[model samples]
Target: MIAYVGDFGLARFLSDVPQTSLVGVKGSTGYIALEYAMGAKASTQGDVYSYGILLLEMIPGKGPTDDMFKDNLSLRHFAKLSLPKRVMDIVDPVLLEEAKVSQGSGNHTNTRKRMHACLISMVRIGVLCSANSPRDRMEMKDVVTEMHAIKDLYLGVRIHQDEQVMSQLSGEDPSYLSYY
Candidate 1:
C-alpha cells in the first residue's frame, strides 16, 4: 500500500478546506512524464508512469535529477533498454552489499543457484518498471503480483534456512545449515 505524497491535484485538495477537490493540472515535475506535462489528460497510464518513476526512486534512494540524465542517460531510458546489469552499477551500495550476502555463502549449489536467480529476477523487474514508454511498462497489478512472488520465494528460502538452524541447535543434524 505504497502512497505518493506530493503535489498531485488530489493532495492539494486534501490540504484545502472541508473536502475540497482540486481541479487543474496535477503532478510533480521531473517525476511526471512528458505527456502529462504537456497537458495530456491524467489517467491510469499517467499513474503508471509515475509509479515507474517511484520505483526508480526506491531502488536508487534518490529522486531523478537533471544531472543524473545527461543526454538520454536517464534511468527511464537505461531501464527501457533492459540494461539491468548496468543499472546494477548504480544501485545503492548498501543494497548491493546486502544482495551479495544473500546470494553468497552456500555450499548447496542448488540454493546458491536459486538465490542468484531471484536476484536477477528482482533486477529485471526494477528495470521493466522503469521503462521509458508507459505502454512498455508493466501494469501496477502485474508489478504487485511479481513483487509478491519474489518476496514469497525469498521468504521460503529464509524459512528453510531457519528450520535447518533449529535442527542443528537440537543436534539433529549439526551440518544442516552449514553453508561452507
Candidate 2:
C-alpha cells in the first residue's frame, strides 16, 4: 500500500521554461480559451476561463460538450441565459434538494430566495471569469475574495473582514441581494 500525501501537479508548472507560442491545440477542446485556438500564448486568463467552465459544470451538472448544445448553443450560453432569474431551473436538482434539507426550514420562500442569491452571485463570478475576451476575465485574487465572501454568506457564519460581516446585510429584515 502506498499513499502519496501531496499533490503532484503537472511538471509543466514546475518547469519555468518558456513554452513556444502558438502551440497547436494544447488543452481539451471545451476548456481551452479562444485566444489559445487563435494561436496566442498560454496565459493565466486561459486557466481562469477553464476554471469558470468547471464551476458552471458542477452547478448545472452539464458537460461542455453535452448534446443539448447545438445551433451555436454552449454551456456558457446556457448558464448565462439562466442567471439571476430562472437560475433554479438550471441548478443541479440534487444540490438544490440538499440545500433545502440543510438550513432551509425557516420560511421556505425566504430560504429559497437566500439560496438563489448565493447561487446567482456564484454564477455571475463564473460568467465573469469566462468572458470571451481574456482582458474581461477576473484576476485570481479577486476570484478567491469573491468566493470566500459567497462561502461566508452561504454558511451564515460571519467572516469578519475589518470587523464587519459582509453579507447582503444592511438593516432590519435581512435582505439577500436576489430579492432586489
**Each model's total of backbone clashes:** 0, 0
**Candidate 1 residue pairs that clash:** none
As for model 1, its CA RMSD to the true structure in angstroms is 11.4
Top candidate when judged by TM-score against the true structure: 2
True lDDT of residue 143, candidate 2 = 86
Task: Report the C-alpha lDDT of model 2 over 98-149, residue by residue, as the tens digit.
Answer: 7878874576654555567668777777777788999988887898997887
Off by over 4 Å in 1: 1-23, 80-84, 98-119, 157-180
* Model 1, span 114-172: residue lDDT tens: 44344444545555555555576667788788667656555564555544433333335
Worst 10 residues of 1 by lDDT: 14-23
Candidate 2 has what TM-score?
A: 0.74
